[model samples]
Target: NTDVTDQRSAEEQSRYLMGELNHRTKNLLAVVQAIARNTARSTMPEAFLDTFAARLGGLAASNDLLVAQDWSSVHLEDLVMGQLRTIGADEDVRVVVGGAPFLVCPQHAQVIGMALHELATNSLKHGALAHPEGRLRIVWTGASSANWKLEWDESLPSALVPPERKGFGHVVMVDMVERALDGVVKLEFRSSGVLWSLNVRGPGVGR
Candidate 1:
C-alpha cells in the first residue's frame, strides 16, 4: 500500500509538470507569432530576414537568462546589459546605467528585455549610439517593493524627429511594454535628444 501511494504521487507530479510545460510552450509560441507578424509588417522585403533574425536573437537572449535561473527571476542590470550587448552597444558607444539592483519575475523580465532590445536598436540606428559624440544614460528608481520607474535618456547630436513611418520598435517601446507590464510610458522630445520613461506597476516585482 505504501509503495502504491508513492508511485501515484510521483505520477501525479509528472503529469502536473508536463501540463505546465505545455501551457508555457503555447504562451511562448504566441509571443513568437506576434513577433513574426509584426516584423514582417514593418520590414522591407529585402530587410525582413535580417530584421526578424535579430529580433529573435534578442528574445532568445532573455529566454536564456530565464532558463539559466530556472525562470525564478532575472536582474534588471543583467537584462539591460545582455540586450545591449547583442547589438555591441556596450562596446561601441558612451552608455551609462545607474540604478539600484532591481529584480523581476519571468513575465516582467521578458517584456522589459524586449523593450530594452527595441530601445537599444533605435539608439544604435538614430540616437546616441549612432555617433561617437553622442551619449546615453539609463536609470531606474522605486520603493522597496513596487512602483518602479525606468528612464532612458539620450544626448544626441541634435533633436530627433519621429519617423513618418513608425515600426515594430515603436510598438514595442510604447504599446507592448504598457500592455504587458501594466506600465505607463512617457516619451519626451528634448532639444538634445529623446527621453523614454516607463513606470512599472502590479505584482511581478521580484526579490
Candidate 2:
C-alpha cells in the first residue's frame, strides 16, 4: 500500500508540473500571436513586423543577459554590444562605441536596444549601409550635468534626399527618443551626410 501511494504521489506531481508548463507555453504563444497581429496591421506592415519581431527577440536576448547578471543593472557598453550581436554587427562594419560604461536599468536598456535596432535597420536599408562607400559613425558622450548625448552620422553622398513621408522606422526612432526616453532628436540633412543627434537626460533625471 505504501509503494502504491508513493507512485500515485509521484505521478500527481509530474502531472501538475506538466500542466503548469503547458499553461505558460500557451500564454507565451498568445503574446507572440498578438504581437504579430498588431505589427502586421501597422502603417508600414513589412517594416513594422520585421522590427517588432526583431525587438521581441532582442528583449529575449537582453533577458538572458540580465539572468547572467543576476537581474542587476547592466553596463551600457555591455548592453550595446549584446544588442549589436543580435543584429550581426562586427568590427569590420566601422561600428564604434565610446563613453564611460554606466549601469543601465533593465527598462532603459530595452528601450535603448529598440532604438539602436531602429537606427541600424534604417542604415541598412536606406542610409549608410546601403552603399559600400558609405560609412556610419556612432558616438556617445556624457555631459557634466548628467545628460547623455548620442549621435548617428551616416555618410551616403550618393543617396537620395529624405523622403517627404515619414515611415514606420522614422516614427519609431522619433517616438523612442522623444516619448520613450524623454529626449530631444535633431535631424540634419546635410549635403555630405545625414546627421542625427539625440540628447537625453539619464533615467530619473526628470522624475
Candidate 3:
C-alpha cells in the first residue's frame, strides 16, 4: 500500500508539471506566430531580415518581463517602455507616453508589445518620428477595471500624404493585435500626421 501511494503521488506531480509545460509552449508558439506573420509582410528580402531581427528583439524583451513574473501578467508601463526602448524610441523629446497604472495578461503584453514596435518603426520610416520637427503623443485611459483605451498621435512639421497601399504595420494592428486581444483598432492617416486608437478588453488582467 505504501509503494502504491508513492507511485500515485509521483504521477500526479508529473501531470502538474506537464500542464505547466503546455502553457509555456503555447505562449512560445504565439510569439513565433507573431514573428512569422509580421516578417512575411515585408516586401524586400533585405528589409525582411532587418525588420525580423528588430521585431524578434522586441518580442524577447517582452518575454523577459513576463518570465520574471512567472508568466502571470505585466505592468502597462513596463510593456510600453520595453517596446519603446527595444526600438530605440524612448527619447523624451520625440515620444510621450501617459496612462493609468494597471497590469495586462502575458498574452496581451506580447501582442501589444509587437504592435508598439510596429508603430514605432512606421513612425521612424514614414510618419512623425521621421522628421526632425515631429513629435508622437501616446495616451491611455481606462473605461473600467476591465476595459481601457490607448491612442497614438503624431504631429509633423507639414502635411504629408498617406501611403498608396496598406503595409505590414496595418496588418499587424488590424489582424493580429486586434484578434488576439479581442480589441478594436482604428488607423487614421491625416495630411498632418497619423493617428491610431486601440480599445482593449483586459479580461485576464492581474493585480
**Minimal lDDT window, size 10, model 3:** 198-207
Q: What lDDT tens digits, residue by residue, belong to model 2 across residues 1-207? A: 999999999999999988966874685566457546655665474567566878577656666666677556777677667766776764546566666656766555656665666677656767776777788777777733568877878787594477576554465567655776688887776665678777887654222
What TM-score, over all chains together, does every model reach? 0.90, 0.69, 0.83
How much is the lDDT of residue 127 in candidate 3?
86
**Judged by lDDT relative to the true structure, which candidate is superior, 1 or 3?**
1
lDDT of model 3 at position 175: 80
Give the range where candidate 2 is weakest over 10 consecutive residues by summed lDDT: 198-207
The list of candidate 1 runs beyond 4 A from truth reads 91-93, 143-146, 189-191, 201-204
- Relative to the true structure, candidate 2 has a C-alpha RMSD (angstroms) of 6.5
lDDT of 1 by residue, 1-207 (tens): 999999999999999989988988898899889999999998888998988888888999899898899778888888888888899886554899878877878988888888888888888887788877999998888835557888999998876766667688888888988998788998766767779999877555555
Predicted model with the maximum lDDT: 1
| Location of the lowest summed lDDT over 10 successive residues in candidate 1 | 198-207
Model 3's number of clashes is 0
- Which of the two, 1 or 2, has more TM-score? 1
